[model samples]
Target: MCSGPEADFARSCVSSITSSGQRATLLTADGVRIEAARTPRTPPPAGPAGAPADDLVIVLAHGFTGALERPALRRAAAAFAQRAAVITFSFRGHGCSGGRSTVGDREVEDLAAAVRWARSLGHRRVATVGFSMGGSVVLRHAALYGQGEREGRTGAHADIVVSISAPARWYYRGTASMRRLHWVVTRPTGRLVSRLGLRTRIHDRDWDPVPLSPTDAVPLIAPTPLLVVHGDRDPYFPLDHPRMLMAAADPATTELWIEPGFGHAENAAGPELLGRIGEWVAARG
Candidate 1:
């Protein structure tokens, strides 16, 4: 949502700054290397004797062109860590991760890998919080992994899913930002600019069989709590996208939050909002 020269400069600074955490190199099931970081939860004040530490982990899936090192994502991680341990990773084709971005498709494997990693850390519960393109992936990931369909890796499923600023369907050119994004992924010159300016490597081939759309995937996420969040002023996707998702989900378990003055994804998310999201995960995940 940021624009103009000042916003550009601020974005540059935020992207350049590195986040502090325990760094690790992860390999997805498809054999792609992923750059990841884990920020341990901040221990709270002493409580009753023999009370256990927080056993929940939040796996953060950043939007397109976002990375684990970006300051905006780092800040979100820090905020969430106050309530639970946080895991942030760069999707393949972004940051130092290896592989061309399939946009949203195939990214489910990446999220699954992160969720499995969370379980390996001895966490009793795993929550997925995704933004923009990541938002769609979380929905699909929960649907795919929730049913234990992929090689019986039921361990990869998320206990809870949070999607923000995600589109409902594919090939939507409803907004200027989305139109420009399509150009960037579909044209050679635009891809070059994206590589040099955004550091995001996109795949050239189109989807063979278009994967399930976000709205269609929402219904399958039932039983496992789902939260759909969108900004009133998001330039990439409109309010209708969230509404469609909500309509597809079970009203009994799914929750929708329409942020009043929010913009888009990680860049728009601040400490207060991130803190509230963390609290929601702790209470519900």
Candidate 2:
């Protein structure tokens, strides 16, 4: 790693005002135009032979009802961009993107498209960091790639995966919030919202036409390096969620990092944890 006042600082959404960065619009397979910001490195850093660029691209996905530039995600993007290429995006029906939240089912397509875009850039290793619903989306992508659901990529090419406060298994009972979410989704009113195509929500209070869950598919991503971070005291998914997810992963390559007293998203994530995350991904290469 190199040093400078510049390198000391990461390129976040706020810092983007002074750098070369822009949003990339990709119309997903479903025809909804999901929006993502690409934080580029004017000068990519050097690494070991065949190593990821100094500015490895990290695609960030937000939790329920979050925008591409949510304050927490922005801070994280800035922090990680200090060491890699970081991109953050809003899922459909959330932020400025079209359509409503699909509760991780339909959002998988959006994530898949984003992964494709990252690959198109010729980056040998792309890492995905997702929070909440975004984590669900990332996990789903791993499954799709794991099983060759689409084009058979199984994202076997991706060098790393980072998930924070994600529900490793859906429809689990430990959190009151999770129960509420299930209630909302199973309710008639929630189904109506899904039918109407509403976006800009964290929790989809509606019915999803294709509600394939993460728990049901997480096992498919075996052999791929996995990092599952969670807050032990989180009232949302609880510590057990990540534990369950790791159970399905290869123990040699899987890591479960528990943050004390953290919540369900990126806001509470500390610099130490962020740096640890960077070190983890970097070490994998």
- The 0-to-1 C-alpha lDDT of every candidate, in the order given, reads 0.85, 0.68
Q: Please provide, for model 1 over 1-285, each residue's C-alpha lDDT reduced to its tens digit, 9 standing for 90 to 100.
A: 222332132222222224545666677889877767778887766875432247789999999999887888888888888778899988987877777799999899889888887888788789999999999999999998888756678679999899988999999999999999999999999888887799888889999899999989999998999999898989999899999999999999999999989999999997778877877888874
lDDT of 2 by residue, 127-190 (tens): 8778888887777777676567466554433457777888865567666877766665667775
**Backbone Cα, N, C clashes tallied per candidate:** 0, 16
**lDDT minimum window of 10 residues, candidate 1:** 6-15
Stretches of model 2 off by over 4 angstroms after superposition: 1-18, 41-55, 149-157, 179-212
TM-score of every candidate relative to the true structure? 0.89, 0.78
**What TM-score would you give candidate 1 relative to the actual structure?**
0.89
What TM value does model 2 have?
Answer: 0.78
**C-alpha root-mean-square deviation, each candidate:** 6.2, 8.5
What is the C-alpha RMSD, rounded to one decimal, of candidate 1? Answer: 6.2
Residue 23 of model 1, lDDT score: 62
